[model samples]
Target: MHAAEGLITGLCALACVTPARAGNAVQAMPVDAFLDTLAVNTHVNYTDGAYANVRNVGDDLAWLGIRYVRDASPGSGAAPLSSYVYLAQRGVKFNFLMHENITQSIEEVTRLNTAVPGSVAAVEGFNEINNWPVSYHGLTGIAAGLAAQREVYTRIHDTQGFAGVPVYDLTGFEPKQVESRVNSADYANQHVYPQNGEQPTYEANGDTWMGNAINGLKKYQLPLVITEFGYFSSPQAGWYMLGVDEPTQAKGVLNGYMDAAAAGVKRTYVYELLDEKPDPQNKNDGMHYGLFRNDNSPKLVAYAIRNLTTILNTSTVQRTRVAATGALTYTLSGMPVSANSLLLRKKDGRFVLVLWNETRIWDRAKGTPLSSPPAEVEVDFGTTASRVDLYDPNVSEAPIASHRDVRKISVSVPDHPLLLEVTPGAPPRL
Candidate 1:
């Protein structure tokens, strides 16, 4: 079977680890210390149209994913396009996914480099070569796909304008096919959609679909970019394949980001910013996967993403054990659950502890939704905290609560993640 087909058929059956005894156990996973790693996908064609929305979220985003099209001028003549300039002004970088013919791609790259040098950080070949529609690159099979990608890579590398820029190979849905096509490109790329008719979690066991894809690319020893990864939410089912509710979509987005960061991927761009249409009729309509609705209003997932980027984009993250004098406990949907926490120390000396219930609850096929059972978790920082603030992703308000000069804090950990901002001191030194 084709690798993409194999993944679709096999990943759902992959055994998941049975829930561990419901209780608090110190998670030993080391925190990833990379800032400016969050990126979101946007269309070059939509850059001008979606300027306002882009401006709203652009500040938090590190990179913008766009398609490189021939005859498409991001900006007129010697000046960089307004969108490019806007992103640049906000300290955001952009990467192009080459979709047009190689000749045009080369010319576009030359024009881009000449017009706005250093604006385009990386260029990727065709996208999702193993999936339908996107897979149709006028190439018949895998062999043809490889040859076409090689030509694109060679031409991009040989272009004088793209001298210092990194050219990425075509990002494919199938790992083996993508791996086989890899040549001397500066970096590697892949598109991982782990949704299996449910809300997916970051399984540390590396058995989940996303985990398998990450593992597959590790062999290349190249910096990886997950150009597209997201979940679709629809009020009515059957329109989208992995139909999820707003809350489920929100959880999936945050979980996907955390998973990719934890796996040490160089960068990850959520599939899209806005919906293509108002309401999608089927999986092929392309209207439901956006972080925002077609009406330009922010969806639940959008706020969650914004909150995650705001809190987790720290310069350094240190994993410290929470020392509590008394036992702290929590439960999810009546079942005892352990909360996962990460201590992130920002560049400004502000410390934030991201806490979330580690339990996986949604399964679309089974009609299950993300469980939001609440629990009170008491944690004592190794040192005395001058001030504490709670930031919940699900809520649209300034820190949910604030406290002063507390050595220990009792936080109500919900199924969704929460950020506890503490004054810069009192944690065990990493």
Candidate 2:
């Protein structure tokens, strides 16, 4: 990776332990209501409930990124040309779905360009085309999907004056699909999950994330934009941590993005800003992967994501908690890091550290996994920095070590780490 393009996220490590005073002041307020809190930050982008929530939540967010869909339904359906016009006029980017009518879809895209001129960010031709019977049915296969994506991208780029209109090929399938899509699409769109439904908690997906990312570099070497990634494992299981339930399925969705960022994939827009509604088509609660609840309240994962965005924008590496000497020891330097200065704790309670390397090599000899239902570890840090703790702010004010003991931390070095926290009066003093 280029020095500039090298992953800055890998090097920097964040101390999850924050002094009580450095607690997220916005925790008490509803996330939806705290939209103003992110306005000044450069990382957290906002979008009103695009496909679902009717409110223009973007107004309060920092960046007003929007997903414009020309398709009418969640599953496969006709391309809604009117939807493009509506979104284009609103100055939002359109996430184009590759539909049955490629030519008609192209025509609508042209009209959108003419309508909004240069307002669209990029166009996403299809979504998860690698899934069964969609675009990789063996009849069409991955090649056909690639051709379709390239065709759409070429047409848009070759337009009268829109030669550079970027195209995003979005997919969130396994490593096989990621390889296929990168070989074809103009950009990489990945979905993430810490583990398959079988695994316990947020354990890294191992070389799965790394393999796909390296594939992207080998094939197109194109820019990456993670279209849909969250904590959902599958359509059934979801992501959950501590006492807060975030369905393992949801965690699967998030793990993809986490994996992507660690692998140095850029420009990730978390799956859906709001929870998905009944599939106006299949009607089976099509993936409850919303950052916020139906009523616009934030989920535990949402806060995790919100803080993650903060960490990504400001800090570099995401620290996972591990237990050693009956104390909390964060696996800070094991995984890949792209930051310059790795910090443990600095002034103002912010776990802001510089990254030194793009890809981190682990010393497995130093770490050991705790037994199941793991033992607790106390993480000590000063209480003077401004830190954004990555957890469900709604969690109780219990002691750090006490809270950490309730669950087991995954010890898969360079793969996964449990992100924990320390409240005020809980800092480890020298």
Candidate 3:
């Protein structure tokens, strides 16, 4: 990967032992909310290499339970005329990247929305503008980008087809500076790739709040969109950021999603769905950034994500109105400094407590998993459960551990995400 393309997520890690903070209150969000925030980047429009060889993107996406992908507009000419129509027809939504020609972008999505209504997930401005600066009509650099951004916002919002669509702001610029300028968009955009294959919470610097604050993207008062972020599990490629193994990639990406959500990002699209080039020798840094290999083979990260989505998928309709419900409180103890938790409620009223430790687990220099004793975390909802289940995506779809009629459960965390299901028993009716 290029130096300019790296993502600095600002997730920090502490080496020494420090007690994880106890929650003052447990805030619960719908599981589907986090699932919807998870998205992947794709070069489906590019007709070359693995992208050219693989034709079952829709199938792969369905298997992963991922409904959205990031792609280039048809008019960009890097793609043939209407190349992504088939994928759109398969109920796949796309966040289209706008090329130089804004008119072509409008026309392309118009055609798409006409064929497949609501096919457009979002419209992104120029990517990594710091590296690939835009020169627009005598205007150059940030000035041109700002002009084009305002134009895109105006055109997208004014048009009937795109009136309801959200326009994400451009990346690779001073977000703090842009807030006062003409940064026109509904959502603030960011691209954060954690440094040195670090844990998603592992901050390169002393500041642990970087992932949440994230170069001041959170301060914009607009919903943050992580357009591009992921790890390339290639050790052969010599770069400043040391690449990790495939297992570490899986854990890091999953941990990254949880971290991003906890940080309040509206959406996160991991970079590139498939490795475009097949570097058998593991030489190319960019080639291995995919969840799938060039041959469309599944990586550990892909399976874990699949498992996660499958466990979260429910057949029940979404609750339109949130009923009067009690807030469930749970005591978390013995959590390491890197341990984190998120509470999610299923439509059926089951609570899913996600526990993961973001402590460093990959020895980048040795290219091996850093071995350490599993840290145990105990959680007690203070109410007996009628149904208790647990799932570790890296293991299998089925619950790897389970308990019933118990209010407390102890689990081990080794840089892995564990989902615990608790259907708290109802209070005794008078």
Candidate 4:
């Protein structure tokens, strides 16, 4: 049974609603705090091109999540500790995973704290203990896996150097099976991938499949962290197919981040930073799950994420009200008539309105990008603004000017997200 069954039943008890009309009466939440919950998963070796790719995406990542020790063998003399030190020197904080032998994992954590005191943000006991090889205890059953994690959790906390550092429970792949065992550590950690090929939409009360998994863990009342969540671009033989083209991957990622934040997750990490090498014999060997391609070039989704983090992370934001009528209601050419928006007041007193159409942009049956003519969207800023700038996430150029001294402005909205900046009085310094 799916973990969302309980959440679905609870929501049904409240009301039954359709997708387009689901969040019509919902109130907006603080975007700045939501952005603070964003993080990207990365494997940086410093020697390989991983470091450069991480540096590029680091501005948006809250912190890095890497293996407690390097992925290389102990005899490889790769010096993974030095790489951790390098990241610290470059101002990159991290949450290290302990999936190796218990003694070595403890020694590594001790060494890490000694090298850069208070550098490690959180230490996870193990990873995906329900699955073999990845599970340090090599236990297949949930009960045994929890017991092994409990031991590691106790050992890590009892170690001399890791007193104040928070230790997270092992991240299980299935939420329902491990929800009861999450209380063994300081915080609850889980990995959720909503790869059913549906757009991440929420109910009147913010809820999605991912949100339901989070809600399932709410019984423990522990701080939650989604250690890894993302979609792949190609399908592997044994794994379920959640692959989409680059653009859809970008949209799914952005939607996933927003949904997780709305669910009140403390932190979220996208699967990876760069695409790994695909198997030569099988093209779709499930290795291409990175924001950047294997050659170290940025994908469309990379720019989308960068644009989102840039706009949302730069300023502190508080939720505000916007009258949704002429300017805010948007419709697609032959698609759904719905507008998704977030209204935020920046710390500098300027207002930012983010808007996007809810129409599907990808045809799963045909496996191609869906196109629609831009819909015009207008919004009343409540007061005459000195300047208004419109930014398209698909493009990386400067924003276009909309209008001056007008309280209301209408602009064409695309399937992708657009950022609108409205200054209340004279244009503030950019």
Candidate 5:
């Protein structure tokens, strides 16, 4: 894990710890571990774009507590993407995409490591090769793509500077294309986009789109990586563009994070950290992918993420030897079909039960977020005898409500997530 972690860690969750509640765990993962799974795409090389337009790139990212970034490029030798250098010195890690120029990318990674040791999280191969077909020395289609991946994978492993770094493979291909590729990756990689302002794990062709994408890449038999997946926050319409209202974007983002983790995706990188350019007319899909606007002001998703990281963080509090933790035995009632529940364990021996309703709240026709009745989720944690604190990252990091001396609690689950933090008794008084 990086000095400051992200939110993309997979089910390495409990680290093989025996479950005290057996299989009663909902989404059993450590908070710090799950925070390691989250990352965002960036454009530090777009010197004239939205990323460069605002001078507070690091400030914004630090504000949101993001520790990793995936970029198509990391600027050439001349500029060297120096803007993010300061943050890299602190803790940020990069997963540089090598689809454009593998040799140049290798050099850049080597140079970056010299400046900042242990800054490379991963090195990736051809991106969306279907759209940008690879043609190496007359090789075309999947052949060239595979060959390039092989070269990069081998080179990265052979290069002493970053040999230990994992290599992610190409995406954007048919299932046939995926099947053609073999032995070229440590992780099977793919991209997913929930269309038409839908839920992050939106339904598609009788199944969740994410599930379908994961299945399509299952031939790799390797841990999966969602290299790109996000919704643009522009209030525009048309199912193809994937633009939704900001509120919907925020809700989908949180839902998508949990959905990806729940699906066992090794990591999920949201499309971007900042809009690439200004789209005052709300017309450009690429311009609105950022968690922050072109002017560097954060969107709703940004604030929501900030609150989330703050709530889940254990570094801010005193470090103590936490008790052995297992799954929380609990029952949730009145959860709607759209509702979802995720239970996360913290290294500090706390449990955060995240509850959300994925109801369609964005009316694209009206270009606004529609209000839905809150689901009164009655939660009964088996034999609860301590305090339970509730927090809504959409609102604030501080607990919005708390309960004491109660075995059951009721939470008004809205479209977004509400975390119920339960404090277990002091190990039954020794």
Candidate 6:
């Protein structure tokens, strides 16, 4: 059942799980599962009261292999220690920040980690350092701001013995700031607003939101977290990028993660779980980006996240072509896929061979890449062949596709499309 169906039955959520497919350019998994398999950390928004929700689902989520939690200034008197304890009891593991209140941030993180005895993870100095009004450095500039942050980060690490704790130094996409964030702290916590606070407009082709993260953070190779992401509706209703609706935001999350994965970013956390108040710009906003409504009922995006997590958390590897030989021959490696709504592509002259796998049933999903078992593959016989197959070593099944002797096979490409030709016993003539 699709995740939206759960909303109708009062199950609190619907889950979207896309099965693993073979030979595709893009792949996806759920946020939780994606983080877990990668052994990366995840954060839940404080606004959603997700502390309890995360606790409730902690065990199931643990299967996804998540280890740390960013409490977004929780222990600094914004919320209660019981909130931190709730997460600890669930086997979730650590904390991302205490509060920028410095002293409180340090004290609380220390207290929580000590009490939980290894559960309290790390503490961030504050939220986005480069963006936000409070972080404004004025004429001091990004370098000066980073230097200041380094001072703060160093002091926190040294004097406080907050030393062992992983300090999540965060910043905006500003190039200078990103450089500083990477240089200043242990983990590079980034906030990406791919849609630029606009509603998402879906097209027949893949959504643009998928490429934002790749373009935004491609330069850095540090351990990173997309701490916040959501569809921000513009103030003017008529000017909204996507009409104020659930489908648009749901699609945004999918496309956003797909883009992140395609860019090879392995970890991401959605902006918020709950939308308690309306955004200042648009009264109808905020609530729309949440996985759950203010009342705690799951939205379509929530289910999508859950099911995608199930797939990503499992023992499956999703990949993209960092370098391709051509439309048909290439070297592929795993990419960070957190959900199934990914578009995989290969540039082939005038046409981009792209695959759109909205539904992740690899075999059923169009554009599945067929594998040629190492033993059966030959570089001798030639008969212009376009073949797609999935070789299940475990099942000893012939390629999953029905085509036997490959000339050309009609296989659907979905969001992950591959364009290639394979001829047994055929060798390239240079």
Among the numbered candidates, top TM-score falls to 3
TM-score for each of the candidates = 0.71, 0.50, 0.90, 0.71, 0.88, 0.56
Supply the TM-score for candidate 6.
Answer: 0.56
Tens digits of per-residue lDDT, candidate 2, 153-223, equal 66767767566666777443344444454335677654432222322112232233333334544454666
lDDT of 3 by residue, 146-240 (tens): 88888888888888877678998877677657655334888888776666556666532453433534546646677787888788887523334
Candidate 5: tens digits of C-alpha lDDT, residues 141-183 = 8778888888988888899877578999866555553564455
Give the TM-score (vs. native) of candidate 3: 0.90
Ranking by lDDT: 3, 5, 4, 1, 6, 2
| After superposition, candidate 3 runs with Cα above 4 Å error | 1-6, 9-25, 181-183, 203-215, 236-239, 314-326
For residue 6, what is the lDDT in candidate 6?
Answer: 11
Superposed model 5: Cα runs more than 4 Å off: 1-27, 53-55, 75-78, 202-207, 314-323, 426-430
lDDT of 6 by residue, 214-310 (tens): 3344456565555555553222233212223454455456555544454445455554545544444455644445555555565665555554443
Cand. 4 TM to true fold: 0.71
Q: Which stretches of candidate 4 lie over 4 Å from their true place?
A: 1-35, 45-79, 133-140, 156-164, 177-183, 202-208, 235-240, 278-282, 312-339, 343-347, 372-378, 411-414, 425-430
Q: How accurate locally, in lDDT, is each candidate?
A: 0.56, 0.37, 0.74, 0.56, 0.72, 0.41
Q: Deviation in angstroms for 311 in model 2?
A: 7.6
Q: Which ten residues in a row have the lowest lDDT in candidate 3?
A: 11-20
Which of candidates 1 and 5 reaches a greater lDDT?
5
Q: By lDDT, who's the top model here?
A: 3
Give me candidate 2's TM-score against the actual structure.
0.50
Candidate with more favorable, higher TM-score: 5 or 6: 5
Would you list the clashing residue pairs of candidate 5?
Answer: 6-35, 7-35, 7-37, 7-38, 8-36, 8-37, 8-38, 9-37
CA lDDT, candidate 5, residue 84: 51
Tell me the RMSD of model 6 versus the true structure. 12.6
